[model samples]
Target: MGEHCDDEQVVVKKLVNKRYLLFKIDLFVLSFVCLQYWINYVDRVGFVNAYISGMKEDLQFKNNDINVANTCFTVGYILGMIPNNLILLVAPPRVWLSFCTFAWGLLTLGMFKVTSFEQCCAIRFFQALFESCTFSGTHLILGSWYKESELPIRSAIFTSSGLIGSMFSGFMQVAIHDSLNGVRGLEGWRWLFIIDFSITMPIALYGFLFFPGVPEHSSGKSRFSMTKYFFSEQELQYARRRLPARDESTRLDWSVVPRVLKRWHWWFFSFVWVLGGENLSLASNSTFALWLKDQQYSLSHRNNFPSGIFAVGVVSTMLSAVYLYKVARSRHWHVATFIAVIMCIVAIMIRANPIKPSVMFTAQYLGGVAYAGQAVFFAWANIVCHDDLQERAIVLASMNMFSGAVNAWWSILFFAATTVPHFEKGSYALLATSISSGLVSVWIRKLQNRDSSRKQKLSYIDANDMLDEDDDDDDDDDEYDDQIAQNHS
Candidate 1:
């Protein structure tokens, strides 16, 4: 009875410790991660939000100009993904991310001065260079702090924060257009930049102050100075024990090339996101906003209507995250993949048939459910690459980098703004992408499952071999004892 009680006490203590550490992480780390990602989206998506708001008219953009500008951002965005994430290995996120945020905020402010399309593209390119780290960088940080089982929801929350930013961007644009249009002899679209800068600087400032670098290699001093003491020494030990061993280093070596190439993770996860990003071609296409615009809806209607899609994205992202964490638990990533595929079909049907605008709008909103795959796949990659921190960082960065690289051209070919409203070609292309995404996800999951099974089998065989050796030694001992007894006789 005493032994059982002791075991129970140990279990309870560990549970309490987990909760306590989680409290610290949520307060000090995830707050900045989520908020910065929020600000990141608001700024990154601000142009599209504003394009529909008034920038298109203000700049006299011809056909396909919005997409051309977006492509510039995508190109510039992917350029630094690998390099910047690599920087996180040598530099603390507090320093690296903070500086990037401040620079990006400055660039956002620069958007306030652009009067032409060329100028807009130039500023956006630089902004993308600065903002590239936000997505993959935060995923790496979240993976660093949270355990595997705990990651789905946290990852979901992180991804959802961006959609929340997007949701905010839509509503804020409407508000800005309503109240701030011509307030300072500037269009409301321009004010989006000003407000974005205001929001971004504060998030950047918070990150500078409180962003605990990586949990494993935290600085003795955060800008907050007290963050290091948040976890008890014992609790910190348990936290580190929960995660895989990570080597801390600043070395950049060519050996990283072959190491990354040898892993299925780099090639597969990165490719998976290319499909995932394409699976989301409909939302990225901004079809609902275009349909509203094509129907000559008011700027408020266009901006406000698309907000529903982002709203659905936010809810679906969280729900999927919770489902994965509590129920599906990642043995069923295919379920999420198929959900994405279904969303693509819905988009295709809406585009193909002469559906009512309301029905089409419903289809588009439902399509936002596909965005959940972002949380799903990214968290899966985090799990797969958890053993090596550098690989984790590289795979995470390359996933987004490769996706954005494909999307630069992918958008032009399939989702061009010039092809707005109907977007027949893009719809079919999106459907094709769904097939690819589902197939890849299924195959990858199967391979991972096989590998896990193989490892277990090897471990079992090794254990049995040891047991057999022990039995043989026991027989030898028995024979020797008998010999001695006979001699005494």
Candidate 2:
């Protein structure tokens, strides 16, 4: 008895240590994912800082040229998404994702040597091409490890990386502008690229070793490994009923592309993101700061102003995720779009307000709140498409790719140089896109409700049929077995 008790104690201690180690592994992976996303955004948007610094003069860029370069980068970004997602299906995410990080980091460093408008556009386009894999791929991996109940918070945490990156880029740029403008005869913008690239290297290396790939294949353990603590064979069966099945014979087939192409969910969510991305342009592009400067806001104020938008965004997103999860309802559409429409109106009002800096600042922060729906919409897509892993991954990438493609020409055409300060065309597009997205959200909810009802009816019929078949088999087996038993006796 004493020996048995000692053995039991040792086993419990080992189990406890395993659980602790697993949690640490998950925490490390989450932090690494967040950092990768942060660096990706910083590299992508560092150009905004470079542009505001001495880049435009050095490259002799016209405002049209600047818009064109952003468009180029976006085009490459759009082109890369679908292919990268397909690769994710076959390849371990850690390998592809790490290689992508290293490639983009090199591309960002390459930006320091770019001398002309054409060279800047070229480097940015390829950098975006390589950088495109991180966000959607990371989100897909998040979905693999987490359930629907855990998703919104993870998404909120993931998206906060971008906001933090945006905010940090501004501060870093300001610091570089102040301290490194003439360091080593290279401009501060050059230093921005060098520093940003350097930061990405270590992060890429860390991720390569640590990120858990897919759920069943994860080399590192996670919080969910606690299943070993409480689950027995009976409990495992009950849990398996709720979990999705794995198809052992499944191949990496691309023929499913046409079926995916026909899904209305993919298109509607894509449209949702395009609208979400319009709000992003207000922050993503340096357009807002340029517009503010044109309206005579001082350089220092311009630099400090946009950071508040992201700060508000971080708070709004976290709260929104919590609320949506608690309520467990699909009313996110109305909440998100209504705020977006309000932001556009406020922006228009600010543009019309010829005198007050304070009003415009308030409007921009409100706009950021409106824009928090980007996270909601993507999370919404995940929920809607959770039944099929293939479709879910494809739809997520499609949403982002379609949005990037639209924004490429969308930015250049409606938000060109001559259109700045007012951007009459872009403002109207925002209003229209907001309305369109809202209308589609209602339709998607209807479809989901219909699907739920259909599934219930099918399940009922299947259960009834199964009962009838069991009754028939039991009657036949008993009668034949009784005759056979009497003959044998």
Candidate 3:
């Protein structure tokens, strides 16, 4: 009884230690990545806020320039996505991610000095190269430290930080335009860039000082050895053991290309996001602000009103996370279908040509529900591809990479600045993408079920084979015992 009680006490203590370890990971790892992503969104949307505030007039912008600049940024984002994620394998995430953050911060500051639309495009293209790291790279890192059960909420929080940043950017731009418009011979729009740079650099430094790299590769001897400082040896080992077992034979090499190409995970997930990315046209393409501008609203109203989209996004994203974690059990396809339904309603509301301001506002804000899929789908991928570290990294990156590739042309073709105040073609396109994404999500669920069934069958077969071998051994032992008895007689 004493030994049994002691065993129970040991189990309780281990659970306590594991909870403590998770707290530290949440504090040091999750917090830094969240902040990094927050600032990344701040910088990304800062360009949009700036354009509407005063940069449009200051830079003498014309039709299609905004679309052209966005295309440029998307191109650069596409170029960097896969390579930057793969780099995390060869490089410590803390170092590489921090360096990218700092680099983008510097480029954001450089945006303050742009004199032409062409120059802004040039700077944005380069800024995008570094900014591309946060979304997919952080997903890879989150998958590294979190279990299947722990991922949805963490991913939701991570994604919501960016939405908060977008919301904050609008408010920040409003404040900066009101106070800092003419300060230091800079327009309020330009000040947005400078302030974003200021907010970004410190987060980069924090990541360098405290962000733990991958558990499998954490070593005390590395140049920026923050993992050892933040985590104990036992905690680090527990972190490794807590995750789903990885295939040790899978190495990060050229062979990974063919391996990923052959797998349904890569193809299905990549195509899902490609369709999913376009589903974001209403909010992502800044249609609210464009319609507001076309209606000739004040600059402050323009910036402030559109933030409602992100505000709704924040609430929906959090709620969806809770639903996914507690109720849906990571059935992301349901969330995807729900988003499609909501977005389809929004697109129809807009396409129906409602003149009422409240109607437009409701439709636009409801569009934010689409942001919920960001966390849901990525967490689903992480859980699906959890067994392969290399595959997880590549698939996460490819989802974003392919999405960006499609957006490069899709936005210009569908949600161009010229098409605002109605965007009839864009509306039709959004409907198509939303329905297609829903269908693809259902297909993905079927594939996942099939794979799971296959694995279960294999496990059952192996277990029966082992049992058969044991029975044969027992029969041989009995025969030997009978022969020994005969010899003795």
Candidate 4:
């Protein structure tokens, strides 16, 4: 009875500890990353908001200037993605992420002072260099702490927060332009930057003080022992042990390059996201706003109407996450295929050049479904590459890096600012990329199935070999026993 009671107590205590650990992680780690990413999008889209509001007139901007600034930002974002993700291997994420957050916040604040398109492009480039850390970095940290079952929803939540930030930026810009414009001799657009900086700095400090680094490196003895206050020693040990076993021997040195390049993971997943990133061009390029501006809508309507697209994105992303977690169970390819089909229809609708606002609105909102790919594909990559820490980090970074590189040109070529209201070429491009992404997703599923089968076969062979050895030992023991009996007789 005592032993039974003790065993029950142990089980109950473990259950309690797990719940507590999850609560702390969700509160400190998940919340901080979401907020950081939220602000990242807010700052990123602030320029476009400013452009549509007054920056274009103030800076004497031309049609392609927005694309030029975006391309420069993409260039910086691409340059930083791989290197920044690699840095997380050696430096603590708490320090590195927070410092990057702070650096970009300052740059965002500096945006208010820009006097020329040239200056705007220069500032956006540097801002993107620092801002590049949040997306893939947070995915890496989430993979470190959460189980496969727990990851999809959290990733969805993290992603939806950015869309929410985008939605908020539109409304916030409208509000700032209404209230703060011409106050203290600063344009309403300039105040947007100042306000974004204010919202950003507190989150940076929060990350510095409370964000736990990865489980493998989160010892209380480290200089950034802040994680110690948030997690007990036992809980920290649980955090590490609960994750899937990884090759602890793997380091982020030059050897990782060959190891990564030799694998199908790097090539296929990177290509997957390259297509996935282009799939996002319709919403990410602010095409809806451009369409509204071309239609001669009021400034408020220009900002507010585009937000509906982001609203649809938030809904689609959460639904995909829930479906993946509860029903699909890591078959994220299903969601990818569905998104491609929906986007194809959306592209066709817009390409028809409908005269009604209702048709355009429907097409634009449906394109938001493409954002679901962000959560689905990245979660899939994290699960597939869970065994190798360095490979996982590199793969995630490479996926985003290569996508950003392609997007730098793809945006300028296909979705340029000049191709507003109709964007016939851009619409056709979206159709092609969406179909390609779906096809690649199927290919990834086939490869994953092959790898799983191979692993199963190897496991079965090892088990049979062990059984043979045991049988031989038993036979030898019986023979020896018989020999002893004969001697006694």
Q: TM-score each candidate.
A: 0.87, 0.82, 0.89, 0.90
lDDT of 1 by residue, 51-95 (tens): 888788888998888888988999899998988999988888788
C-alpha lDDT of all candidate models, in order:
0.78, 0.70, 0.84, 0.86
Per-residue lDDT, model 2, residue 68, is: 90
Give candidate 3's error at residue 407 in angstroms.
Answer: 0.8
| Candidate 3 pairs with clashing backbones | none
**Could you tell me how far off, in angstroms, the CA of residue 281 lies in candidate 4 after the best superposition?**
0.4
TM-score result, candidate 2? 0.82
Residue 267 lDDT in candidate 2: 76
- The candidate, 1 or 4, that scores higher on lDDT is 4
For model 3, residues 1-489, the per-residue Cα lDDT tens digits are 999999976554442144567789899888998999999999999999999988898899999899899999999999999899999988988889999999999999999999999999999999999999999999999998886667878999999999999989999999998998788888899889989999999999888878877787765456766677767665776677756466789999888889889889999999998888888768998889888988999998999998888888888888887876566234778889999898889888878974568878999999998888889889889978877889989999999999999989988998899887778888899899899999999999999887776653211121112222233433453343334322211
Alpha-carbon lDDT of model 4: 0.86
Off by over 4 Å in 1: 1-16, 222-226, 229-237, 245-252, 328-332, 456-489
Whose lDDT is higher: candidate 1's or candidate 2's? Answer: 1
TM-score of 3: 0.89
Instruction: Pick out the ten consecutive residues of candidate 2 with the lowest summed lDDT.
Output: 458-467
TM-score of 1: 0.87
Ranking by lDDT: 4, 3, 1, 2
**Can you rank all candidates by TM-score, best first?**
4, 3, 1, 2
